[model samples]
Target: MGSMSPIRGCRRTIMMSSVLLFFVGGMSATDGAPPTWTFVTGGRIVGSPVVTETGRVYAVAEDRYLYAVEHGVARWRYDLRVRPIGPIRVSPDGTVVVRTRADSLVAVNPGGGTVWAYRHRTEIASFEHGGDGHVLIGDSAGVITALSATGRVVFRVAVGDSPVTTILRGSGYNLFAATRDGRLAAITDGGARVFRRLFEARIEAMASTADRVIIALSDGRLIAVDTFGREVWTIGVPEAARRLGVAGAHIALISDNAVWFFDNSGITVGDDRFDGLGDTVIAGDGVFVAAGNAVYSVRASQPRAPVARFSSGVGAIGAGGGRVAIGTDDWVLSSFGNAHATSRPGIGARVPYWRTSYDYLFLKDQISAGTDQAVRATREMISRVDRADLAGSYHTIRELLIEVATPRTPRTGRVIPPDVRSAAVRALGRLGDAVVRDFLARAVAAETDPLVMVAIFDAFTDTGIVSPEPILEIAARYLSRARGAELSGEIARAGVDLVIAAHRYAGYVPDVGVELLRRAMEAPFPREIREYALTAARQIDGR
Candidate 1:
């Protein structure tokens, strides 16, 4: 669930979501259906896609380019030097505003012509266009910029090093900028700091809901204040989510991938089932999931119903009048309540779970591999994983992520992909069902992959299937008969220190493991393996 950022992996400002052509198409009203997939290449589409009243979908990709799409076809594109990291925002009337890490702000007309362009004093983060002819922007340098409708720089004020909180506007063109530096300031459209309040921590989000204000803070807490800036209610969200949506007397948010719908009264009324989403939005009546190569619309109800589903890598979604405008890494779709299923392999509702479930391990690997930008692209790739459908290569995919996570430190984070056997072992351990214990034990006995074997070892450990007796037996086999010292060394790779530490705690530091250590003390295995095993047995063997 960690976002793809350099310092912290959860920030949205620099993220990008881009994946190449994949063919997974099949989606029906029922549980089992084909998912359709298409390849649309422009660049990483990390920023959420936006749709105006006319139904044109606006999206940006990592190629540092912004594009407009309609009805699944490409339109005009605006290429930029610095990638647009946040979603394109549209004013209620139809003006489009885009922000880039370069602090470059640009506005365009509906025809994709540049209406105004102004490079900020520093890189601007997420921004919004106010109906009052002002564009509000927040940047990583803790500065907020307000520009006139004509792109004239109005005023700039420093906030802190963190990205600006959501630019919030209220009645009479009053503007508020939330800062992570623990201050909420009332500013005019010109970016003049009118008033300020000291809060508990940095505020991450600020929004207006008809009558009250919603300010979500860095501490994973939400503070509702009145128009006068007095605190009314404070709600705490222990697990942070990516985006916050508040409008029409309702609050839509997520924690741990579960969408929580709260009314203006702040009462929890509805929630969509938990599913991992690279990005999400709250608009109209449905909760949309921009999961790994596709987008899905799940209604907010007693049992959420599926309204429409499209390819993963979808970075943005806008809902209205039975239509949901979706933007993916490469393509865009304006689904007008289409519930039709596909024939090609396409991700269904289970994507968010499977991708997030198995991808956590891979996500860690990718993070350990590379730069924040490489990781930004990698995160979007993992977000769209569905191995059963050959549309996505799980192994090649993992390799790509490993390259991105620790690109320079390639020696590690390249662990072999867990096959069904390893996955079965983990499953048995988790299920606690005794029936599969022997099967998992046998599979472990015959396993060849060192990484998979250790994972098997953990599964058996988790299931209490491996005791000192079996450990000793396996150690004896590996010691003399099992002719694979290299593999033994591989098992010894994750650090025999932790293994010995666990043995010291569990009283299972096997005598045979010790004998193997003693016999192969000079073998190909690293000195650390022998040292730890010998040290552990001597320390705890009751000899």
Candidate 2:
């Protein structure tokens, strides 16, 4: 093993042990062989590579080119003229199918010729290949369309309002479609709706076993339903599952911190923890996990270990044709045989877990104290805390801030000191999470202190909220209240801040906050408020 060069901005690295050569549960240590073949792509790979049964690999890159490689050599390249979306797939007839950013699906023949192309009127959300050589596509309009191998529409059905995120083919001509809003619909092959089930959270990923369809929710719940759409079982984890893969009767749920395996009845089989996050695919009897810069092949009976490591971060991974294909962030694609291989010994990295720091407890205590100096110190500490630690501390900090900012004696008209409240609001704003947007909106509506109002408006802006309709509507109502009345100095200052915050969404949602900005421009408000409002409105109008 060679000494590793220092990785820029990396805090820690794990050194592989030399004496570790034991085989566990029929899985042996890698023989440390090099990759069978390596190919460099024109750009970073967008999704996982697809390997056909004939050892041909298909990969798409950001450069808008679909590459074909066999045995480490470039076979042919086709220009799609637009970046492809999602992973490239092959139909039963050996035609390559790829969806593009232009809302079209292009199928290429074995000789790299365009066989046919199908364009959708709406954005293609998800797609899957059916058993009868048909392409099942789900669009943003909640319509599922099945196209024959010749690019003809076989049938179309409207599932629901939310965009479909996944499509799976079940047993005996049964099909399943899951939407973004947590609605799973089971449809027959002839477009007849069988049943539909709705969950409480967003559907993140889905996979199917022999007799059950596994659904993963954004709230960290896994559900299994039978062919008749009846709930079979459910389980919970700490983090949401990003991807799901099925190997025989075992299901693998890949989350940020770990890979959990469950049996046919939702019983825990085995699990492995690793740092960083990546994609996974189940091939043969093993689950290939791409994490950080390495791809680890984990058998159901063995602990996780890296089979291949790369110099750069892995972008995507795929397994087929008795080999594993990996795409790296450095614009390279490589293939290796099923046997365990390693580029070199004693080379691995793990991100340090910083959640164990004691500073979070100290900051929480100081913020809860609610003194002016304590709040100030807490604010400084919040800014210094790493963003990774925010997940662990966000709820604690938010609750403390809400408690300190709320008035304890509303009946007597006595409130928490405005300065302390304002500081806490500013700290909440610095959290940069939109989950607190509703709380900030409610505080702005109920608070009477103008200084705190200004802080709340600024915090709302700092949340980086993509959906600003609710807050914008509130601003319009507030502006309407001050239309003909004399605006106090502090009130005018807060109004100006609100206008400035509303300006950030000018072109993205031109119509959302236009009424609020117009109201700001017409009020008995100060000249600064009117100027900001006028500028914002013009930007929205593209003047």
Candidate 3:
């Protein structure tokens, strides 16, 4: 789930009931509908489109032109005079850049004037924009070059024999690059090598933050490595990732037709798919996925049927400055939402927003269906409702959640599946209120499954329900299983992590974590649990 940025205002923000669209003469909106507009261009768009704060759209078309569009009109156009070699890049200073097939990098200002141009000997394969007027360009010959804002060659690094396929800019002056021959290299702002790692399979996609770099291999395996190039964890994805992007707290893997989301720990949180060759880009609080003739908007915090879909072949997606824009194959550039009200599609009429709940409890479907598509939708809904305090439908949704979570005994020959019950227990906590607290208190008291007990305890922290009574009750039950199932150690550790997280959420000082850790250490817990407790204590003490 996407972490909520500090509560921005007193007004409660609501997630869309479903994708937003106006019912036209006879058309009804589906779960993936949203209001949109499109501007047909002169040629096919090959690179990604960028939306600036002012709602101006920038995109490159095969017609050898770079366009700046606003309110459905071309504000300015910079003639590249040659087809772009790779993705279009925009710098922090609002300079648009594209490496042309003519072996030159051209930076154009918003006014359609060329700021500067740099010539290179080899074909540029990929490039990344590092702030402070720095641009990192990599070529087919495995060479990486750092260019100053004024088009000066700052530094260059060469790797193996294959082409450089991905370049990711990191915090400060550091940047990372990957080659087709399975080499990952990091470079400092001064163009010095930080570290490099080689893999067996070629890299298909890459994304990074200040602390970690995530790479997707050709074999559908995703790996996360720290700045030092040490493997943190690896996950086998169902499909090879065609593009990787970071939206808020989730890592997005855009596959052939689906978008998979992973949390910081490399666990699959949720995913959604569409028909067509899809690509994803982060825009505001949503993930705008472009596939075929439509662009779907998936909220970063929760997946509720796509909140919106626009009719356009979105080749590239970009969001910034409170607006979103997409470029299509038919030479159309479009912007969506209130920022471009004058260009709103669908009869160009205002539509009032309506709030509603899902027809069925998705939490149940996720646990019972066992299908990839069903699980994805269910997880998305759970993640969204867990964080979205939707007050309007709270009573109705709460009643339904309670009904689903009611524990019951089965016939003699069958028993309630642990997975199914666990999902119920989790839904109770996500509801996160007095009624939920009452339900959880009774359920945990009789819960025998260690896994369900652990999930319940974790949800307390997840929902910010910090009652000490339930915390103590579940903690004791968790510690009782210290030497049980093989996963007992893992569950115990998770409990400790949650306790610390809860303390942080409640605005307690680090000493509170220190105190909790000390208590766990002094208890007669298993050796592994005690060791883990001691480590957590020391880490907190250092703070």
Most TM-score-accurate candidate: 2
Pairs that clash in candidate 2: none
Q: Candidate 1, after superposition: displacement of residue 269 in Å?
A: 1.9
Task: Estimate every model's Cα lDDT from 0 to 1.
Answer: 0.52, 0.65, 0.60
Q: Better model by lDDT, 2 or 3?
A: 2
lDDT of 1: 0.52
Query: Best candidate per lDDT, number?
Result: 2
**lDDT for model 2:** 0.65
Per-residue lDDT of model 2, residues 172-262, tens digit only: 5467899988898776555545556788999898887766688888887888987657789998877788888676457788887777888
- What's model 2's lDDT at 393? 40
Candidate 1 global TM-score:
0.51
Give a tens-digit lDDT track for model 3, residues 262-305. 88789888887666566566643346676566656664455533
What CA RMSD would you report for each candidate? Answer: 25.9, 20.1, 21.3
Superposed model 1: Cα runs more than 4 Å off: 1-46, 62-65, 72-75, 81-83, 157-163, 190-194, 291-301, 308-322, 328-334, 337-543
